[model samples]
Target: MRIVIAEDAVLLRAGLVRLLTEAGHEVVADVDTAEGLLKAVEQHEPDFALVDVRLPPTFTDEGIRAAVLVRSQHPRIAVLVLSQYVEERYAAELIASRRDGLGYLLKDRVADVDQFLESVGTVGAGGTVLDPEVVSQLLVRSRHRQDLELLSPREHEVLGLMAQGLSNASIAANLFLTESSVEKHIRSVFTKLGLAHEDGGNRRVRAVLRYLGYPDPGPGHPSSAHPSHQEFRP
Candidate 1:
């Protein structure tokens, strides 16, 4: 895959470039600042962009903001954010626009070279990949929400895997169940969450994440009304 990297740290930036290069992926452009990252994306139009959540100047959320801009302007270019800390808000915002072709991984994950490369390839192919830490954080926040209470213990397990962008096959393997059984659990999850089951696209992904409050409701998109605890049938 052709890639663009945005990292403020010199050693980390060089390491990423070397890693990708050795892995046979082309590093089309590498930049240290968020502004430069945006310009590099606009110029190279790489298939994937590996960004850090913190960048130069403020060093708060510049990389994330630039990533959002890339998604808005270059929808086809996938973004994978590598951060030192698992900031739930940043993860939520990154996945808010669309679930597919997005990733948020903690910096420590890079040590697992094989898995890290796999994640990059997955996101490059229009898949979602969230750090296990991020998934845990989102799950904790959602657990107290009224809608999430509708899920059974098993269903909650399935939902957590779903939020990790795992396919039914993967969730089935991890949970020691048949793929069909996983599908059934997913359907039940969608029903309990009041999300429509569509024949195609990432509807399930969107539903699970949105229910966890990842998708910020923009203008004209009112927030979903959480059903009363008594109203939950599941």
Candidate 2:
């Protein structure tokens, strides 16, 4: 697939190009600024694009803003956003577009090359890919919502770790429980949240995002160092 990358960090940009190329996908274009990145997409019409959450000028939401614009102008092109830290507000804005070929993952996740590649392929195939951390953030903020208030503490813990992008094994390790127990907690959380039963996949992300009041940003805005609610980020 032809992919465009928009990231301000030169080293990481080059590293991504090299990695994707080695994995046999074409890196059609790479740019450091959101404007240049958007222009490249307009020119190249790549199959998908990887955008950073922050870019030039404000260094805040420029890249994300660009992605939103792209979604409006080019619905067929997929986008996967990378961020040092994700905000529920930003996630809401992106998802609000109603575009399916989207992803929002933390930058640290890039270190897991295989998983990163899988995410790339996933979006390229028109699937949504959300970082578990983003999912966790959504769930925490939603707890205040009347529908989610009844979750047991154990179920809440499972949901939080799941949002952190932990596998059942990892969740089990963190909670000092068996993998089967972890699965049980997940099922309980799912049922309590009134989510449909399926393979789950990115639906979990979407449900949690809606629950957290993403586009609205809930109560107050907090820096990455401090989140308004603890359940969302842990």
lDDT of each: 0.82, 0.79
Which tens-of-lDDT digit does each residue in 194-229 have in candidate 2?
665653443345435434444323222232223344
Root-mean-square deviation of candidate 1: 15.8
Backbone clash count, each prediction separately: 0, 3
Q: What lDDT tens digits, residue by residue, belong to model 1 across residues 1-234?
A: 999999989998999999999999999999999999988987998999999999989999999999999999999999999999988888878888888899999999999999999999999999999999999877755653667789889999988887666778889999999999998988887777666544233445445555555642322232323322212112
lDDT of 1: 0.82
TM-score for all models, in order of appearance: 0.63, 0.63
Question: Roughly what TM-score does model 1 have, to 2 decimal places?
Answer: 0.63
Candidate 2 error regions (>4 Å): 145-234
